[model samples]
Target: MVYQGNDPKSNDNYRAVFGASSAPFVTLLEELPDEKRNLRYSLFCDNLFTSFHLLAHFKQLGYEVTDTMRENRIPKNCPIAMKKKNRGSRIFIRP
Candidate 1:
């Protein structure tokens, strides 16, 4: 989806994509319906969006989010493997 600077309500762009240097998910989340914003939902996002900040933001926005992380985004001491022996297991650490 493209970011429409002057008209955010629509994803259509006149030409160029102009937006704040923000997580792409942040821009997408901003378009949520007001009431649904407070409802809990399971969200699946790409690796580019998997970060502590995004996780916290998703939680605050009432989402149970799932995503894989790049090693650097994780703290050195935290072992993601030990937390899960297989897929679908999640560890939520409060920032």
Candidate 2:
């Protein structure tokens, strides 16, 4: 596992590679050994690492991804019901 320092200088390589958006998560996945990286894998992550862009990126790479996402991270155009309106319910969105 990689340790990320709070200071900006310590994360320069991560920033350079991923630019922005869930770099820590992306870094871990990308750093997998070649055999693991080439095989299809299911990735499960928490809200802190979940975003529409990250989901799409892994989906395109043939990995099955599942995660809990913050309400704010939901795309504005998505039709999922608001959390308050559908407590304990499951909502699925397909692209």
Candidate 3:
């Protein structure tokens, strides 16, 4: 499930995950009878999270995830780009 929260000091946008645990998702899932726990779900999260434990838990439960990263943890061969339309109408591919 997706819900919005805020940083206490700056009031920045924050998203919370509640799955297989928590009051709301638990309540919702509990209402559904005979539901299989093997079902897979996808989640997108920011790199602000330091631990991979939660994501590993999801993987153990057969779920898939696509995470956005703020850290330079990926390999060098990975393509990283920032689009700037104001620069030009040309397309340049760099290695």
Candidate 4:
């Protein structure tokens, strides 16, 4: 979905439906038809739309999510190694 920018009412509506912490990308997923939403599908998104909480939310709903996340988005206590340390190594960290 395209965000027109600065729509307080739309943001409020999304928050009401998806909760206060919901990102706009969550709204895109939530806007899917009920039938589509019920299907357990794998979704791919970019860092701009990815977050640990978002992944957890989708996982709870039986959907698979794969996306790149910003380093700062990683939980401080997560066990994943830093980029330089993990370079050239295969490290898979699941949310």
Candidate 5:
């Protein structure tokens, strides 16, 4: 769908509808169905919209979201382990 910022009547400016100072996506989520308001739904979004704040918001709503984050965006405390040999190498990351 096209977001016609040129059309003032069109609520295409998310920042305007959601508010610039809002905790990011609060306004965006408000448009969701009332039944799904506080339920656990898996949200799959693009990397541009992924952030800890967004995830926390989803959690607050009892929902979950998934997206590929930049290396720097990942929590540094997560664990990672690796074992040798090209023939048999075991690399594991425990969340």
Candidate 6:
């Protein structure tokens, strides 16, 4: 997907490639604009894409990475580990 700016002079190119899995995502990234291509950006993906290589690439590009561990599926990697943590039914964190 691309977001077009209002003015031609202020226009920027943005692209998003959706895939069934991150394995393909990595492959797709190889085809995208690289840091040497003079582009600065970030990545927003699901937990299925939370891998060391992926993070490294985004970090190299000076891009902030955001990935949620829980989104109706099991997470492959979690920055915030859920292991040994208790899951209560009626507890919510929003204050």
The per-model lDDT (C-alpha) reads: 0.60, 0.72, 0.42, 0.70, 0.51, 0.49
**Cα lDDT of model 5 by residue, 1-95, tens digit:** 22223433334454454233332455546666887666667766565656555556566677666655444545677453222347444442223
Model 2 C-alpha lDDT per residue in residues 1-95, reported as the tens digit of each score: 65364434335665555345577676677778989888988887788778877888888878888788888888789877665665767656555
Spell out the clash pairs found in candidate 6.
none
Whose TM-score is greatest here? Answer: 2
lDDT accuracy of residue 26 in candidate 2: 69
User: What tens digits encode model 4's per-residue C-alpha lDDT throughout 1-95?
Assistant: 57555546456755555445446667666778999879988887787766777778788888887677778878999877667675545455454
The RMSD of every model to the true structure, in order and in angstroms, is: 6.9, 3.7, 10.6, 4.0, 7.4, 10.6
TM-score of every candidate: 0.57, 0.70, 0.36, 0.68, 0.49, 0.42
Clashes of each: 0, 0, 0, 0, 0, 0
Q: Look at candidate 3 and tell me the lDDT of residue 59.
A: 64
| Per-residue lDDT over 1-95 for candidate 6, one digit per residue giving the tens place of the 0 to 100 score | 33232333321222132223444554445556655444665667767656545565667756666665443454456444455567732222221
TM-score of 1: 0.57
> With candidate 5 superimposed using the best TM-score fit, by how many Å does residue 78's alpha carbon deviate from the native?
4.6
Lowest lDDT 10-residue stretch of candidate 5? 1-10
In the predicted model 1, the residue pairs found to clash are: none
Arranged by TM-score with the best first, the candidates are: 2, 4, 1, 5, 6, 3
Model 3, residue pairs in steric clash:
none
Q: Is candidate 2 or candidate 3 better by TM-score?
A: 2
Taking the tens digit of each residue's C-alpha lDDT, what string does model 3 give over 39-85?
66554555554224445555665656666543354445645553444
Model 6: number of backbone collisions? 0
lDDT of 3: 0.42
